[model samples]
Target: MDSAPARHTGQNGTGPAGGGALAPVHPAAARRSATAIHPPRGPRADQARFALRPRRVHRRGRALPLFTADALAAVVTATTLPAVAPPVLSVAPVLLAALHAQAGLYRPRLAPSALLELPVLAGRSAVLWCSVAAVTAAADPARAMGWSALLTAVCLQVVLACAGRGLVNELQRRAAVRRPASALVVGPGAGASAVAAALHGRPEFGLRPVGLADTAAPAEGAGGALPLLATHEDIRRAVIQNSVGHAVFTRPPEADERTASLVRLFHDHGCRLWLADPAGTAKVTGMRLPHPADQLWGYSVQPLLPRPTRPLERWAKRGIDTVLALIALVAAAPVMGACALAVRVWDGPGVIFRQERVGLYGRPFTLLKFRTLRADAHEAATRWTVAGDRGMSPVGSFLRKSSLDELPQLWNVVRGDMALVGPRPERPFFVAKFSTVHPGYEARHRMPVGITGLAQINGLRGDTSIEDRARFDNHYIDTWSLWQDLWILARTAASFFRFRLGGS
Candidate 1:
């Protein structure tokens, strides 16, 4: 995106040591500064990390009471129609589960009410019992269930399901009051702090405020012993360390790039991000409120991330990766062997230069490239570009320009260290440097690093703005699909011989 507004700020937007804004210091100094803050640890910290698990009833847990009630209802319905009881009892619960899933009965919500969902239950039960009657008729025409039997089944299902779920809701409310999920409040102004305070005072909401992320540094004791995360790094470190599962942002995520960056960061770490209307006054245009209740205290919560799509697409990605890597490795073996020989003959040794590059999820792996320069370990690690170095080695120039230097990374793809198409992997030095300097740089790790990527295709390669490269990479991941991967692969292949060394 555009250049980051400004560099590091302490809590409440204050500069470190009264500088108004801390100047960009050396990376080593910045690392030391980041290391200085020691967040609270021990039993309380452990509790914060583990609290989200079994913290409240949601998703499958919410469905449990309904399932139990439906089972009881199934018995009653079947007994009424003794002739078809066996088949009805065998299929009713399983069919209801599928139908309820489609009707969003399994979807988790912060404050769910069984009583409010009575209409949905009744409607689904009607459809479900009718389906059972139709299936029984098809299976055995002589023993088809009657209209009276179907009506009884539907009525019993709704009443029994509602009764069981009402009991579950009451039990769940008590449990939530006892143990709540850890939450982080994010936004500018006192709105975030106010919502956090309200949660602290009320235990029934099932949210325990662990910290706050705001544009300005919190006033002394404003957070009430909770941590303040002013910078993205601080936010990331805090979220990971404290096991923060929920994020409550007072403003809409679309308010600015910073808020958008927060969405990517939380999504990468798998946190549930929520946009909160703390005062419940502001409303974004074209936003539809969820049915029933969607309030946390006075704040209205809007989830930032959409529910994940079909699992088959994700499974297809792995299948694509493995299959394509194997084919590419075999197909390119001869070319790689030739490049190795060329390097050995001309460069005198060290045909393959192995360096640790940051990959998916900030994990490091050894990336293999043909040695093109005679730099020492320190120079290799810290050097930014060698596009026009006067090294005077024709062999090195040929390998770099021809893109033969990257052939060995096909092995990385096969080993699952990389993908055939994704953001190019950067050395650990640059990963650290860019992650701090560029907003959303670390978010690139959300997808596997690759040798060819959208950034390279768009010409944001060597010596380009790190911020723009991060932008394109994140965009690619955000819109990633199997077809997109195939298209990138096709473009890379079609341009393989003619592809410039700029992307190198």
Candidate 2:
């Protein structure tokens, strides 16, 4: 009657409460409890954690408020612009702002959600503007707003919306700094340490280290008093006790079932579970966790490949490139003419240098540029020119430094062989060699070569490390968008002027 002291049955065994009679424990539960109680060795334990959680989610502060404020400002600016009736303009901006806010255009992180929201925002703005125009026309036949006014309103709304968001962002950044979300990383040994170091170093993301949870005894005592919580039949209790919102598994778990069970249990309890991808560890960059659902639910996560160019996008890009290339060719024609004269006067006859380079899809093409080397230079020589190379003629040095030598590549852009902005094409000899050297080298050829690229503007021109250049190229391929292309072009302009002035 003072009876059993409330014995509890765990996965591995039954624990007696105050020396009470032992209760029968299920065989599977007993085994699990035993295994959990006795932590595995380093490598095995790390493998177990990796098997369980393969992806990691890094949480940063929300950008919703900033987005909302920016949208509101955009609305206000559009509504107050001249030539538009205040009422009509006012309604459109609010609706547009709401659409953009709902679309999450202002999120601090650029996830798929933000990308998906862009078109939705643009479409909603279009519809709202069209509706306003239709209603206004119906109401006032004589005072109907012209197309210019409507267009002006649309442009002003977008500009102001972005500007407003930017201003609010600066203010928010100044007001109070919030710390990064705390992560509870669980793994074998050194792997866990790596995760902790990465998170600690990147405080901009606001991740604060609460503590580490591992199966094996950590080499460093669990930073004094932050218990190395035991793992028994179930990890759910341990996770909850620690109030861990995110669980990063740095190594695979011992059993697939255990991994699956952990994922389900943590997810059910409102915790985000992540597993480290094996392929990610090989790179210097830390492990990349795929989209959350992909990791937890076992979905395929592949790098996005180039699709057949969209008609509208293709035409738009082509038109812009052609028009600009032509204009540039014209404007620089005099300078080019002068350069040609200078080259002939300073060195010799051939005013252009045409080299065989690889183009889209590994196809070979001739890239034309103003001759920046002596005509008598040996054809067999393929060495990359560095600063003060003896091969460069006097005019060639000035042209190469100013990038005026690159003007003729506009012809390549005009032709189908190149794009205005893409990975810079390399010579065929180097291409074959690099392809074998770098595994992801072929990926760059997916897009047509360019006059200037993400690499070039970043000061990754001649003689820079091939590995670093490829990384930037890969990044461009991975994150390409129309806006990004435009940004690159703008940056290229600023860089051109700056370099020209500095005679770089």
Candidate 3:
């Protein structure tokens, strides 16, 4: 069921751009010129905006062939067994699949071979047939399978399963050669270049290296070896332009903070991530692979699974947000109306201030707050205002201290633009500046922007350390749960009455 790679590229990395080599752009210049804060306004800008949305999972089909081969093998082997009732025989395929899955037999592998899996397949087959013999004996002793019959059944099952799987592997290899997925090799210097070259030389691996992704600039004269993707923006553009399906890490992602941050970016784009130790010096860090280890050519490989997202829990959280936001909006309507009236009287005309703020996946959305200042739109977006700013009226100061200006964001939660509990959203200008300054600042966008987050509840409100806030936000996301959200909300409500200057 796996579809072939959408397009084919020539020997050079460029696919639709023809076979010419691209000029390398310096990493520093790219970062300096990157429009991470304000994207250009055009068709390309619109495309980039839409590209930030989470992509659909694509590699689900890659495991279907192995599942099918195992099921068919189980069914065929079941029929050859003697003295088993119809009901007992019918359970063989289902039971065999469970055993194979438990043994990681169906996991997608870079170099899949029946010979490498023969022992596992044989051992699982033995378990399946032995259980069948036991069931037959318990049901009817006269019709029970004997020891010799059970042994033969196990052998027959193993042979048939291996043959089917071997055929599947051959077909998969042929299909991969015909249409290889676009991939990005991530690492700095010679390590990344070597892996990219190996992948380019070996077509059977089903990966066509499209570029070398690293935060560091490539060495002089190395640009012609492959197009160097020096910045996250450059990498994002390459992934979208090439329809990249895979990202192979030359070293453990945790080895460096700059390299470590790209994990969420690739995951957001739905790429199959792999850690390959090409130099054999890479050490396994804290992150663990869900499936068994694999190999790419001669180098050891392992699939890099991100932190458990808990999708079911996330969906539940969304549902809770919508219901609770609606209720909170309805319950606070009188208070919100009074605040709007105060703002209108104090600031005149504009009660609701809408500004573009960076949200999940770094997408921009209009965030709503009561107009707390009389500044113009450009100044409001770019300038940092303090608590005792002369521009602020008494109404604005009270709103800031009491945290009443953010009540309007309840509508954002109801509209799916934000969540009830998550990392606080920030202006695009500050986001761009802090992302460059802090190591893990950009990672805060992985979750929905919340009106009250763990950082804010734990005294990380306005005028706090950006690094500490980023750390707390990431920790909240990594260990997020419904209970923790409720706890944060409780803490926020408990301290809502306390006077705090510069409550953002």
Candidate 4:
């Protein structure tokens, strides 16, 4: 499972041309560098539950200008256009906050140039003021502002916004010179230690090294300012304990399956993942190098991976799930009742079958389904397949093929235990088994488990390739969207009674 060719090697070798491949790093002895790093050991993980540090107030403090500018603009709006309601002015700040957040203005930069972001600021300002003008006009015709007033509002917002942000950036730069965001350096060997040393020695780049995640945890721990974190759990505890906001990797986080697990782990904890390339050779699309080499102490990094589900989008997904699930539950009640009666008649009792299934973050929840097999709870959870079982009644088989047995799951959806469309939930045994054998398997838990999923629609049910099902589930998660969810729902509806359920 170890993919790094040069374990504990400090030197990151250049890869072949035209392909974004990195050659295996040379082992520590091969390159005689001052920062000759080798993997190291750490304290026992069980005893490493350190208390989390108090988070930095300066991070939000750095983005204070964006809020200030909007507040100041609202004041200007009140004085310039007296007809604009106080409530409208109050809402402007919230609008501005969302707009700036989407514009990535509030995102921290290593060495941000306020002037360099003028275009983004200008565009956001225009949009904000234009929206305000339209709202003001719609609210009251008499207070309708002319083009000049709109232009003045935009000009004032842009200038004041830029100046305020510029001041904040300067303060951040000064803070970077003093105290900066805590960081976790990932990967093994010399390159990682060197990056940690540079970051530890120079705080101006805004990264304070706290620990290292040495995937290859060497028994002879490397001697450096940082102690090697022996495992992913240690790294998680380290991140929380140190209030780490940044994760800098000396090599690709996806080089090995275990390393890739660390990537998902980092994402789950909301750390900004970066790849350190001193040679300035690491370039992937949609990445920003932020600062010059000198400013970063010769360290250049690019975002190595996509961010996890954003909080707002996540909330929105939940909101959609709740609304749709509630309606579905109400509409499906009759069908559910009929199915329950049938299950009662066919199976004698316990019309609704509740089986423990793995859900988001590997948590277990009771999944509701009309009984499709004459088996006890233990048998239901432990057995992987019962479709062709001799004990299956004729009604059970018909109910399953029609998917009417799944109607009771609408309540699960309404209870927020599952989504209408997501990676299908599985029993804990399989989750444990697949997570160990398949690298991409656990990633499916990022989103909520669903009643129907991409894997199901593609006929990856019963006895199908677990690897292929995991891939499809991960692909659905990676490309998840509201539109896609709607499309999947449509597809599921189109073939509602087509599949003879088994292989799931």
Candidate 5:
């Protein structure tokens, strides 16, 4: 559904005092905007892609100065004490950094404070010195730190570390006041407005509220002096146009589907996400606060880590796909040959059909299949075919029903054009059409296209609800594992052998 035009606020902080009626946008408006926003062809297209590339600096860059501060403190402590050997200086700094990282000291915080970190800093410092003493004793008993020396070293390290971190925090605060990062307060009601107001009133937090994203309902007063973004398109445009770096949710993201859907959108755009509990209702909603000290203007806040990209596991999945796909093609070569001969004989010459289908990241690739029907380019691309169609020959119907026609897609999997398991690829026309109508339909492109998927196994093939299929596809991705892929393949194989007529 299209949303209303975004509402803006005045400099005096006066805005709409109540929710306004949402106006519907033209259905094709989103599609038109998408096409217009993307450069067709030129140097400008390359520049646009480069500008929108996922930014890795947002989280890591901010943590670098603190890491440096901790490193400096470790080095100073090692050189200042006779109990610490020269070789210990190098190892101590590395060890201290690891310890602090485990304690979450290096995490990006909206409101950073050295004083609040004292307890954790002191504990980690003590552990570092104790470990150093133990290592020294193991190498040379005489060089080991004594009790008095160890105590002095711990205290000195804590003091220096705190002082160094304190200085870094002050510098960061001053810099933030000068140039705050653009942010959006997500959620509706008075809660969102209060949080946005807090961010605007307090510069130390380093986030300037640029807008309010309230997909669930109209935000009261449009979150005070900020435009209300009620649609995904509006929020996306705001993020790109204003260079928004932060997204603060007034409630837990899991509060509802409308709110939960925004997570993938923001993460894909490289925005740092946070869940802020201003009403102290997170506990009631079963939201777990892992870090108590992390806050934004007295409101409990926590960073929402992005979905983990298991590189090793994904590499393993690719390896399995290549190996198994190659093996399957070899094993089924005889059956594929017989099917191809039958198609050539019955369908009058064209044995192997090739048609363009949308694939990973919306890239188009020619999909291979035993000629199931003899349709012209326009009919094949734009028409939807199903089993028992009068246009299809007996051979085509049997091949599709038995899924013998899909054997060629194993080659696609082997060539890395598709995964053995993922959301099924569709034609470019259908992809564009479905995306605008169904929520989360476009998100299916997040993963590689597949031959068979969760939706297929659950009987969503042929004519089915696009919305449900999108839901299943997203769920599969969210909980995907190598084992799940294997299981889906196993089930697909079993069903194929049974000669199930679930074909499209």
Candidate 6:
């Protein structure tokens, strides 16, 4: 059979080491060549040689599969037993299975030994059996025999499955001693060369680099004893002829379409395609694959807590806020009414103060508060109010110190403009300015602004450093939880009383 042709200019429009333009193979031609090379035969004569194929080589440790199969068998056996029945036995096996799975005991990479996992399975099963017996003693002593019988069945199943998997693993290990997969490393660039080197270094990975397909003339004795098969255009043909099962595209081909088409061609021929990261080949550690949604967003917006309960939970929270806000507003009506009367008597009648503040997602909203300042305070440039500011009306100072000034924001929360706990909203001007100074500042808007937050509990209030305040805001966003919010609320109450007693 004629050797398959390669397509595309090697790395930089250079020919193969032998100096001939590589030939391109049509998809049909490549498929025919693969078939022609491997004629079907009966069972392999030598197990060791057959085991050399990549598909047959199980690089992942042997123990993991054994442990998993045994654990599963134990759980199934326990569940099937009639004697062990109750909240104790039923929930225990399920919980242990979940925990074991989470601990990576079932993963192919962490192959644990059957013997090791068997003890763990037995221990969990015993715990479940004991719990079941205890429950039976309390509920009905007569059921104890049925429960014990079920636990015995579970133990037997676990032992049998563990032994079976161990035998299979031993067989596979013996097979691996035989056949190994032959590989052709197409080193078109630094990335490709690096991949080739890695495969060469890890021979147990079942990759045999027959030769490198360099477009440039092979350096003097480049292939060494390995054959320098073909160049760029002949890559596909060469890969097909040599029975390559993996093609790594380290660098882009001369034509984008050609590269894309080549990847598809490889895939059609059952070759695994691995593309090098375009961001440069610096090895990355602890790299987590992003979810499909994360990929779509181009960024992460996960909360520290398990995804916010559910829609019903959110609605419940909103309902609680609305009911509480309404009741508080009603209870404070008399005081607010009296305060209005006092303001009318003392400062000539604007009892309510309305100021524009940034709200959710930077939207502007009118913040309602008791008129603590003279109405004309904004006539000059807007400035942050400080402790004992002369602009504060006599009545306003008492309102501000007591936090009665912020009670009206219950309305904001009720109106859905704010949450009960989140980063405190910023003034639109500050939001704009700070966002420019801090690139990640806008991430705070991912949740609705809140009436109070971690910053408030930490004594981060008016005129505090914006950077320090932002740090608290980010901390709240990152570590938000209903429990954390409750803690902050408790602290806020303590601070409120302390502030009230201390006065201005």
**Could you give candidate 6's per-residue lDDT for residues 1-504 as a string of tens digits?**
000112111112222121112222211122212232332345653552353232321233444555555556656665665565545444654555665555444433211245665665566556645655676667877666554475676577656666765675555444433444455544343333444454454443444554454444333332232344333335545555556765544332211222333544444555543333322321221112211111101112111111232467567666766776688779878877777776677767677777776654345677766676774545412455644668777777777767777777778888887777777765555555555454345446545677677777776776455555666776776565666766776677777777422221
lDDT per residue (tens digit) for residues 1-504 in model 3: 000111212121111111212333333222222332234577788876776545643552446788788888877767776686888656888898889888878766787888878888889999999999998899899998988888888998899899999999999888899989889888765556666767887888898888778876743223254566777777876776667889999765644446767888887788988887666532312233433457776677777654445689889999999999999999999999999999888779989989898777667899998877888888887787655568889998888777888899999999999998998887877776666555556667767889888888877766667677777887887678999988878778778866443333
Worst 10 residues of 3 by lDDT: 11-20
Per-model TM-score, in order, reads: 0.54, 0.42, 0.57, 0.57, 0.54, 0.44
Model 5 has an lDDT value of 0.73
lDDT of each residue in 308-353, candidate 1, tens digit only: 2456986687778889888887988888888888888888888888
Lowest-scoring 10 consecutive residues by lDDT in candidate 4?
A: 1-10
Error of 5 at 45 (Å): 13
Candidate 1 wrongly placed segments (more than 4 Å): 1-60, 63-107, 111-175, 178-198, 202-204, 209-316, 497-504
Work out how many backbone clashes candidate 2 has: 22
lDDT of 4 by residue, 322-409 (tens): 8988888888788777777877876788787788887775667999887777776677666664455477788787776677777878
lDDT of 5 at 204: 82
> Roughly what TM-score does model 6 have, to 2 decimal places?
0.44
Task: Give candidate 5 misplaced runs (Cα > 4 Å).
Answer: 1-60, 218-224, 284-292, 308-504
Candidate 5 lDDT tens digits, 27-46: 22211222322334686777
| TM-score of model number 5 | 0.54
Identify the superior model by lDDT, candidate 2 or candidate 6: 2
- Residue 213 of model 3, lDDT score: 83
lDDT against the true structure, per candidate, is 0.66, 0.54, 0.73, 0.65, 0.73, 0.50
Model 4: residues with Cα > 4 Å off, grouped in runs: 1-60, 73-94, 108-111, 135-144, 187-202, 214-225, 231-359, 362-418, 425-443, 454-491, 497-504
Residue 72 miss distance in model 6 (angstroms): 4.6
